[model samples]
Target: MIKGMGLSLIDSLDTMLIMNLTNYYKHARDYLAETLSWDRDIIVSVFETNIRCVGGLLAAYDMTQDEFFLKSAVDLGDRLLNAFQTPTGLPRTTVNLKTGAATNPSWTQQSSLLAEIGTLQIEFSYLSYASKQPRFAQKAMAVYDHLLTLMPEDKLLPIFINPDDGKPKGTDLVSVGALGDSYFEYLFKYWLITKKASRWGKEYFETVESILNTLAFKIVDQDEEMWYIAERQNKNINHKFDHLACFFGGLLALDAQHAPTEQMRERHMEIGKGIGAFCRKMYTMNPTRLPCDFVNIVGNTISNPIAAGKGWLMRPEAVETWFILYRLTNDTKYQEWGWDYFEAIEKYTKKEYGYTGLRDVTDSQKLEPDDVQQSYFLAETLKYLFLLFSPKDTIPLDKFVFNTEAHPLSFFEAQ
Candidate 1:
């Protein structure tokens, strides 16, 4: 919550900081400093630390012009670099700060999730830019460069990669969801942050086109008019969509703004709107007005509302897309949908201590609350909701590109 709150303060400093939230920033800063000082050798997960801690500190520094945040970020960045000591430039998933020992999870078979290795570019590249250290950026880009050579015939990467050989590990499971979402997210964001100077932007545009062509499906039933992106496994399409995948609509909408031609822009918008509409249905069709973890789309219609998991773990991807669509279209209906979602969260998930996840969002009579409340509930979920309702000028779309965690980083400042 501290990391996210710090970023939130940066996001709306003019309003939030003025609203007696300055103390919150001070508290977060002091806590981070104290923790780092006391636990100088604390081990951390690379993915979690990059998004929440490093991303938070950099954003706080940007907002406050405080050297403290910058210094902390640099310290954390140097510690994280130990994970990249692998032969293939694909960092291990975990790093020990004290011992400088890094290793992948024991469960995986000499492989790592594609999203884990592929999603570090934005944070690491920005760290290099901010600290004037090219090695951080180079290490991150090396992972991308190696992965590019391993793209499949369809140009869609598998969800897992063999870090030892820098090759794709799975052929059956290819997706823009779960283990693959932010890989594509960073491609566009990295391109945008670099002011289109990087080839990653062109790569991002091409990859989106490939995904739309190969993975996307249109469902045109009487009750459902939605576009679902499916996963390809074992030479067959798995007609499944997850709430996590819903972020694609927002990504598509954002990428449309940078389309090269009028025709391309219109096409991107059309696809984005189709997917956005489908994502909204994932919420409205559920009994609790919150989406399940997965829904199966069979042949031209949604087969079941909750075909897979019924839990809603306070995820932000669906609402995050809603925020983007609303920002792009100025459609009040998106706002109305978001309000409905918020009400559902309050009704089904709220607890006295703090909001918890729902064990079954489809069960209204006995709404079971899971014990966990993810930090993203504050970081991405509430932040996106706040941005959705705030003045459009609060964080102008043209001025900022939000990180995967919904932390807005200024494009102008990044350069």
Candidate 2:
């Protein structure tokens, strides 16, 4: 359960600052200063630690210029660095905070998820800059550099990779969901965070072109066309879709503004709208007005919920995309869609103490709460919702880049 990691508290630090909750922010800061400790021997997820804890600390430090935040972030970043001690310098899934030992989770079979390793670039790069430690940047870049060597001309990255030899593992499967979303996410964001001075933009665009050409497709449903990104296993395409991928809509919209050409910009924005609409439709299609975690698209309908697909974990991806699309296009429809989704969650999932996830989004009458409130519900979902209705200038896209956890780390102009 990642005990003592301060998941929700640390993850929501930037949101408190952005929302102008001064007392809450001060209390959180004091908690981090007075209570947070990394000396425990607990095993923590490297990806989650970086995106939530380190990213949140860095975002707070950047906004407030407070040494305590930076000190906490650097301390956490140093411990996380041990996860990259693999032969390929790709961070494993979990690390021991006390002993500096790292290992892949048993289920991963000594291989790391592509997103887990690839998502570290932004957090560590900023940490390096903030702490004046080049090793942090170099260690994170090593993973990206090694990945560049692995990419074929097609640029569709495998979801699983063995850290021992830095080779693609398992079937040649590629997805922009669970195992691979933030890898591509960080590629584009690192370029923005660095003020476009790095090779990240070129790499990001190349990979995105491959994603559009190979993975993205339109599924027809009852005479309606919806755009969704599919997964590829070798030569075969799988019609499985994840709500986690709903983030792509916002990401595409964000990328469109910075595209190198007008055509690219228009193309990305058009597709972004399609994907955003597709995600919004899921809420209406379900009886409870909430979408499932994942579903299989069978021609004209979504059927066969797999694993935990029927559950709604209060995910933020769809709303995050809605917020970005609304901001970028000034479209009131996006805001309308987001409001509807928020209202549904409030009606069904809200409890006396705190909100929880739904056990089954498809059943209107039996909307049982899972009793677990995810940290992202605060770090990303609610934060995105708060920013959605706020003035666009509150956290301008030009000045700040968000980590996957929704921490707004500001842009640093090139020297």
Candidate 3:
């Protein structure tokens, strides 16, 4: 199980880096318009699919110093946040395509949607960072507080929660798929930005690390075989790719303890490499195949190649890992691979929509209807890719590292 600790541990450090990639996102930059076809238009989202079409717009605005992109990103964030204007604090997973308002009464889901809010928080984080607006940070923090209330004792959050009532509406155990990245995204970024262990930050990361430890040994015996969490009652190996979930817990564990035992480091490596290698192998074996749309052990590879776990070669999340790995090794191989994925995605998918993150990239790179274009795909994927390819000096590496708990790792603040 602890196969390549040195390498994987190195790679984990690079996850969700945000130095220069913020600039490379120029092409996919955000822009809102009222064209001939549509009556009203707006920005995209992270809560549900197809909601965030112009996610890269804000990043682009920030990167290029262009007012167009800045307004684009902010406008989109504002549009989505407005939709969550329920009497209750929670937000609907998706909004009206035309009106950009939540026609739904309220959201009952927390795990994935909370993750979504975290992604949105990042956009706001950037808005706050660039403009020094407390409002963006406040909005992002408010969503985090809402999610904090919903997390369970097991440290594994429930799938969905009633935003109106604040009760668990779904299964007891959380899906590693939906909540993992966003959970840590908020945890690490919030800590890095605020540097405060006050309130719930420390407790949040503690729970995240615990849940990830669950994956290191059992569910994923090896790196490649990620099993979906079938039930909260039992979380044993249901061997298959639960791709996003596979990444979730492991990522938190990556930087858990400074100078983590050699063994612990090794486990993280295997997990990272396994995921990368499996994705590579699975895709290589069937070049024409899109990544699995989404797989359940009962019926593996049921969805399109763009599915999770066992799917196509190019994924925002998968490629995002390579960027994380690149930061660790400084190995050109990972950087090279990162470009390869960008090329592959361009080659395989088309741009039906402006925003990119979706489960299935099988068709034209159309953002999925159910898929909310997450701000995270940009924070994690495009940002990492840009960092992978760009000079290290752009973002001042030292500024963005250091967890809220203050894990004294050199990687985030590499010399």
Clashes (N, CA, C under 3 Å) per candidate = 2, 0, 35
- Report model 1's TM-score to 2 decimal places: 0.91
Q: What is the lDDT of candidate 3?
A: 0.46
In order, candidate lDDTs are 0.76, 0.87, 0.46
lDDT of 3 by residue, 144-200 (tens): 777777666656665565555645565454555554345555565555544443444
Ranking of candidates on lDDT, top first? 2, 1, 3
Per-candidate TM-score against the hidden true structure: 0.91, 0.97, 0.62
Q: What are the per-residue Cα lDDT tens digits for candidate 2 across 53-109?
A: 899889889989999888888888889999888888888889999999988876777
Model 1 off-target regions past 4 Å? 1-20, 37-43, 221-224, 303-308, 412-415
Residue ranges of candidate 2 with Cα displaced over 4 Å? 220-225, 304-307, 413-415
Determine the backbone clash count of candidate 3.
Answer: 35
Cα lDDT tens digits, model 1, 271-386, are 77778788777777768888788788867656445344878878998788889999999998889888998898888888898788987777678777788877677778877877
Error of 3 at 312 (Å): 3.9
User: When superposed on Cα atoms, how far off is each prediction in RMSD?
Assistant: 3.1, 1.6, 10.0
Top candidate (TM-score):
2
| lDDT, candidate 1, at 162 | 73
